[model samples]
Target chain A: MNPAPRSLTMDALQFSGTVTAAFSHDFKNTLAIIKENTGLLVDLLAMAEKGRPLDPQRLATLAERIGRQVQRADRMTAELNRFAHSADLPEAQTDLGAMLEMAVVLSARPANLKRVGLEAVTAPPLWIATFPFGLQQLLYRCIALLLDRAGSGGRIVLEADDGRPPVALRVIARTAEDRIPAGETAPTPTPEMTGLAHALQIRLDWDAAAGGWRLTWRDVET
Target chain B: MSERILIVDDETDFLEVMAERMTHRGVHVATAPSAQEALRQVEAGSFDAVILDLKMPEVDGLETLKAIKARQPEAQVILLSGQATLQDGIAAMKLGALDFLEKPADMNVLMEKIRKAQARKMLVVERRAEEKVKKIVSSRGW
Candidate 1:
């Protein structure tokens, strides 16, 4: 599909609200885990005070878990803040690499556990003139959903080729979506991605054949 | 008579451990799996204290605290969890919780805390009984 007339801009309120709500939910859940870990640390300290031998393994695991959760929460809040700031202008010339970095950092836990490899295959930094919030939402959802479907003991390959002509992503999953539990829904991708795609007048292609997913959009020479 | 104490949590293994440990230490222990069931048990029995886990799928520790305190103001409550969130600790304390204990709790330490809370409950009951006596005597009703 041909891109929209470069004359229009995305709305500010819609972009900010979408990112904020997603981050806040994730942060709230993280806060709950942090609270629990802190309390456990307090209990561990008390146990040690009475001359009871502490289990070094358990303590180390607790420390690692606490550190992971804290890092996760920090990254989520940071991304939310960045996404919030980008709402000032629509169709800004932005560095997609930085946004991808933020997304990768935010998904460290799941990505690490999934053993998924994300590679930036672009030769130089790909600067796209697009709505930042919309792009972030789109990429986040796509990556997160692929990760979720990858299962606990699985691997997925993600690559971004933001080359000069057309931009595309190749996602190769080691597991099938049918493997995911029926009760849990993969995190919903925001409408901003679809909206931006609509505004760009480009078809956002999603196909999961040959054991993977592909997203591609040919760059429209301005 | 054994000092009556209530234990509420969803995890069966932990519940069994706590109940068995507390029972072995000469405290009368009763167990419930959910906050709703806990309140039901509270209304049905005379107890000295309660042990609650903070995060449950249906109802959490904070809601349980309010319900338990409202049902039996004299019953001492100690929140328990492996993942006890900070908000849960503060909320439990503000709502008159006696203590918040983390999971995989040391049996001896938990017993000591429970005993102290139980002692406080005994004192409150005694003081209320004394006041009742004083009111009757002063009114010349007895």
Candidate 2:
């Protein structure tokens, strides 16, 4: 295969593999909870069979817990479905805020596992005609990189800044500690990250005063 | 005798439900909602076995298992994970875990493992006692 096609294929494969692995781990944890709840219910029934009175409240609570897990799994699958559909169109008018929110949800587990708080503070909803999948990849990678830099006990606040026709998004770490030192050059973006941002017509700038990197994009035809 | 087991998982529901089921089966059970809490529990009390979830928020299962073994070498640890790979199992075993079981594990199977763990723990304690007595005798030149 030619180098360009091979690179694109590899990027696609890597993105899908990572996203699927993360979602699977999340789904499995949810399933494990449901399984245990069911097991607990069964044990309760068995006890009742042996003349132990079942507490109606306890049974109700178990049922609620199972229901909650089912809903949690459903939401995760929905996010995965939306993410999969991002590649269906080459470019379209997309809600940047919603896309960023979706990326946050998709990447929340890893961030939480790192004990880093990632909160998205977006400006009023902004719609841009752009490549959705490429932007998604870029956003997810940015969050992952920030979490790695922040380590544990750190907070990262992301903002979809409203500028002129070109959109601006900021990701800032409040604390001075952590991997990305304040007032220093931005952490180097991987080749893949740079390529994704370039394809999306986005420029990355490190704002030392803001304590994070900002992504800016100029107007482009849909 | 009932086996004393500590169950650790980040999911509160899973922890509570498993603890209840194990208690119903005549095992003395304690639950920790996170690996950090599990370490605190390990430091506070000894258990015949520890049923630890592989994936947790911080201080993952393998790391937690190492800490447990360091603090209490005699503690038998059984790792439970929904996303455990072959490498993870091997690493867990190398870190002194008694067994690695996947999530949604059969309760009966787990019960059997716990019983075996309890028996093995008893043997470990007995062997340690024998070694200690032997060392004391030689040191005293008695």
Candidate 3:
């Protein structure tokens, strides 16, 4: 297998950095919660030892809270692990739905920060042979762009359509008001995104009627 | 007087636990889940220090810090972030933040900072009162 182009490699690195940073921040928050809760438990126990009445119910609730946070952290770790392995193989047969879901998961923090709702609609399995990491990177970029346009109190939906030979992925933005004005134009893909799409043999287009961006690629033999 | 402080973060669990711990330590703690609510609380009541999260939905910590300072220049703000960079710390300091601490901050360290914040706030209030008295005396010509 040949090495990826420098520009694509640079883009992927940046994307990975962003996703990793966001995940780390989330992990820190989860850890902070657990730490504080455990500290509270210790404080309560000490008070009990000093003659303060211990409420067993409160203890049970605290334990439950910690358990929930642990579960949350576990899920985040699993998602991050999956993301790390996305780059393992340069090209592989990938499931479009799963890939889109991963991209949505990676982009969740950024979207939440902007007060935008992001969801991945369930789709039937659509397999494609392409650069797995590149596909994810493109999807993330598209979702990010849509999130920006969506602004606060907006929604972004990701869905994969496998009804036809050329499988397509759509990223739709739903805002309270029309994002583009009569004289203004919709946001377009960046040069780097366009370049990546070209390299991956994916046709990227803006669908005005659907008010979304479409990425369609033909299935290729691995 | 008990130290009055407001803890602001998007994480409800964090807010609840921190509030409980600070209250147990005898500090008057109020919690806000968003910048909007934090601003409202700040306007409705006075606090010696504001514990703000650096990263939040909508308005971020830096922007909220600016707003808090604008409303009350004497307001002492301690920024907390889960993943704070050096640049973020510097920026917070430049924006009149009392201090910056990463999340999972040592309780002892945070309590010490709160004590310092309360002391500083008192000093600021006393100095302002003194300046006002001096101006009145000077204008009255003894």
* Residue B46, model 3: Cα distance from true site in angstroms: 0.5
* DockQ of model 1 vs. true complex: 0.05
What's the distance in Å from true for residue B105, model 1? 1.6
Off by over 4 Å in 2: A1-8, A176-185
Ranking by DockQ: 3, 2, 1
Give the alpha-carbon lDDT of every model.
0.66, 0.84, 0.89
Task: Give one digit per residue, the lDDT tens place, for model 2 in B45-85.
Answer: 98999999888887899999999999999999999998889
Q: Considering TM-score, where higher is better, how would the candidates rank from best to worst?
A: 3, 2, 1
Residue A91's lDDT in candidate 1: 74
Q: What is the Cα-based TM-score of model 3? A: 0.95
Fnat of all models, as shown? 0.00, 0.74, 0.78
User: Candidate 1: deviation at residue B7, Å?
Assistant: 1.0
Q: Model 3 Cα displacement at A34 (Å)? A: 0.2
Worst 10 residues of 2 chain A by lDDT: A175-184
Better of 2 and 3 by DockQ: 3
In angstroms and one decimal each, the interface RMSD of every candidate reads: 10.1, 1.3, 0.6
TM-score of 2: 0.92
Off by over 4 Å in 1: A1-222
Query: Highest DockQ among the candidates is held by which one?
Result: 3
